[model samples]
Target: MKIFNLFIFLFFVTTLSNAQEAKQDFYKRSFIAYEGCEDSKDLERCYEISFHEFLAKHINRKALKDSIFFEAKKDTITVSASILYDENGKVVKRHSRISNPASNRIEGLEYLLDSIPTVKPVLDKKNNGVALSTRKLFGFYLNKAKDTIVPIFGYTPSEVPYEIIEKVPVYKGCDESMSNEDLKNCMNDKVVQLISENFRTNLAIKHNLKPGIQRIYVMFKIDKKGRVKDIVARGPHPEIEKEAIRVIKKIPRLKKPGYQRGKPVIVPFSIPIVFAVSD
Candidate 1:
């Protein structure tokens, strides 16, 4: 009996060790692949895959789901959290911003976040492990008939390279209640509309400008306070460049500032405006 029991214990220990090593290998390969990605879109995609893999390996999803289903009484609740990681990928801090008025639900989410295991740090383009902030949204919907809760999760990088913010700065008049993806679309449409309505195409005609598509590139930053500034424009004609800058400067204060680790941060954006003129 003693020999059999010893054999069982040895098997269990070996199995656990192998599992840990496999997980570490997975993380290392994911980060290496992400670092090697060349295109911006490919890099973004790799970052997302690596992030979700990290969450899958480190988070106690089943426990978290149970806690939300059993503890939250609200029919629908949205919980947003900013998770800060150190150079070693250890969670340094976590802050939850719950839109629901229920204190119990908020507390439940806080507890779950606190219980998360240390994650493996992701490598940036520099090949260095740097501190980073990531955001997660947890949505819970209660089904009365089924006596269950349906949970949804969304993840985004809160801090990224200045040129690749996951959520761009939203314009003042855009719908604030929309999801992050929808808000981006709305902002793009609104900016194009503003430029089309205000731009002096008649100037091109008056100047006897060549009939073609004139492209203008503009880069600007929305400051931490939701104000637009640092407008720069380049175009084929000086007048076109001036008009682009003027229209961009006319943008009002944004509805909400960009965020990194629960704090507002300056967000930079670049867009190209193309004008078509026919003689």
Candidate 2:
């Protein structure tokens, strides 16, 4: 069935090249932390990078208690996930959910213990910035699935279609549901669409891509100013990788920038985008 080339390679460039870029050269390194095309979390990381602001735009919890909560609890912190591939590791579909336990930590910090009546607090935020629950929960993993070589285009690799598998979950995190102000502020520009298009066109032109299927993973940042700042990739591919990076570099700033208690800050990105042959 031709496998419908939904090409989304992660990132793979030397550290030396990245260190040489300018602060303004943010888009150039859009997907670095997410190299090696490890798993679905990598893709989710790319989404986090490319659309952090957009996603953050989605997170609005009226009360911390009512923040996005998971349906089930796990001994460790990892969303249930699955990778669809052949017997080898040639990836077909990489699927996963978002996860982070940092937000889940509430009971262990010593400073907050005094707030409770029954017990004398033994912990200290300075000494124990984390809760005991936080101690056991690890919300992320660094490419647990490691491999040196990968199947390049028309070649076969050792892990071709290996069905790389894991049992993470569809856990939900804090909600960033949009507000009237958020909708109004963002609608004037429809920033995500513009960014997506800019990258798409850049890929088609600069990369000399045709009407065939291509996969790409895009990464970028939404600084506190709401501007999409730094971007990089984490894995590799053929010409598609080059074009994907080029496209992300062209997106204009969305909102001026976001703020945390009224200050501009730099957020990082590690998102992935996919390109498929158009009909």
Candidate 3:
């Protein structure tokens, strides 16, 4: 009789666990992810989410998901995650992943694959955590691994090299109910941090040092959504400019791109990033 009762209790627990409903809050995240990621199957879209996506799709992200990336009070291509509210519709987790290359941080380099999908967090634990249902895991990995659209690579006519001073998400600040730190920590703000870091790192690498500071012109289309497109480098010597363009392409994606109206469109932007070694 005792064994029979235990079986019944176990059965009830299983039923209850499975009965939990999948919340709609997860739906809201797709907008944020899509906006912040800016429709890239192969690029850095936002800061924290970019980092997470980098991990979910990145062959090696599995190793460091638990530990936050911190060195010298800064982040180097890592995500800091803490599980918070776990109700059906909420996941109040605190996360930070900063990878500034200018400060000599070895992050965002040696990345061969351009786009990687982050595990789409599902309110259903079955699709998110350990032992995620096979269906969810397979679906998530398949979506990230496969490219939705063929990449359209664009370029400019100028013959000079340049660099992006900074890139960030454009959006209203987080809700007032959020703590000051959390508000600032919103995923959009991290965009600037990522841009600055990538900019500095490329400079440190002497990307354009050989014939530094030549008249170079770069033209790239920023889609209506503000994501970068049609990157081209043109200046005095086309060869070196191409090299610069190559590096520029290495930078991550912009989460919130500039917009003209309701639809996503491409806008043009230019910059001359000078490379000089200080004495």
Candidate 4:
């Protein structure tokens, strides 16, 4: 009995380790696939990147809603949703279960689930497309006044797999007529040019900063209205960080917002800027 139990434990451990490794490999492969294809001028590659980006942004954003809490009188509610995707990657079926159900609240949850964008089928080891399913949980709580619903927590069973956008957000004056991949490259080139033009390179010399390649990380969100917001930057020096933020804030409104399933959605973007300086 001891020997058998030991074998079972070892098997479980091995299986768990293998699963973890496989998950990591999948992410690595996904990153490589995106990076490899992102710059290609091919339409198919551009479309693939755009499709994945839309899926990632749309599904994650629409999966939770606080409005449902406002419609319900209940102090708390929990909902579970299952989304079924067809081989073609469209949502063919959806079902939801509400605990402590109220008619209005249930209706709201149902509507939200139905609005989820059509899923894209993931490829199997054989490179064959297969249907997929995912489950999500949403919790809502009533505010102190009990007059409005507030979303307390939203959870999805699996991380939504999304690739970095094949096309970066388009800036004003950048040619939009180019292919998606070319458009992204153009946007990047323009941003770099703007940074080079606007960045206070003299600040480094004044501060006696060492000569090296300085990297700044910036994060921002493009809202459904096509406006940039929540710009944040961090870098090796305060001057660099400040200048990065200032330049990013000056970005003009996008001609169009990112869309998923034909609906506009908020897309968060992050980029790293490297500046080379010489003594």
**CA lDDT of each prediction against the hidden true structure:** 0.52, 0.30, 0.32, 0.47
Worst window of 10 by summed lDDT in candidate 3:
4-13
Candidate 4 per-residue lDDT, tens place, 12-127, comes to 00000111123533421221122245445452344344433433333322233345434445566544444445545566543333222222244433444455455434455555
- What are the per-residue Cα lDDT tens digits for candidate 3 across 28-140? 23212322554554322342334444434553442233122222232223121212222332333221112222232324422312332244332332344321111000001
Q: TM-scores, in order shown? A: 0.44, 0.30, 0.26, 0.43
lDDT for each residue of candidate 2 in 198-273, tens digit (9 for 90 to 100): 5444334444555565445565655544454456554334555655556656555544333322344343333455
Off by over 4 Å in 1: 1-167
Better of 1 and 2 by TM-score: 1
Worst 10 residues of 4 by lDDT: 4-13
User: What TM-score number comes out for model 4?
Assistant: 0.43
TM-score of 1: 0.44
Best by TM-score: 1
Residue-level error in angstroms, candidate 2, position 200: 5.4
Relative to the true structure, candidate 3 reaches a TM of 0.26
Any runs in candidate 4 off by more than 4 Å, and if so which?
1-169, 175-178
Residues 1-279, model 1: lDDT tens digits: 011000000000000011111344433222222333434444434544544444333334543455544456656643444555566756664322222222324543444455445655555445566554554344455565555445533422322223224344567787776655556666776766776667666666665556666667887877878888899989777886787789888778988877654566676666777666654
Local distance difference test, candidate 1: 0.52
On the 0 to 100 scale, the lDDT of residue 159 in model 4 is: 12
List candidate 3 stretches off by more than 4 Å.
1-213, 276-279
How far out, in Å, is residue 35 in model 4? 28
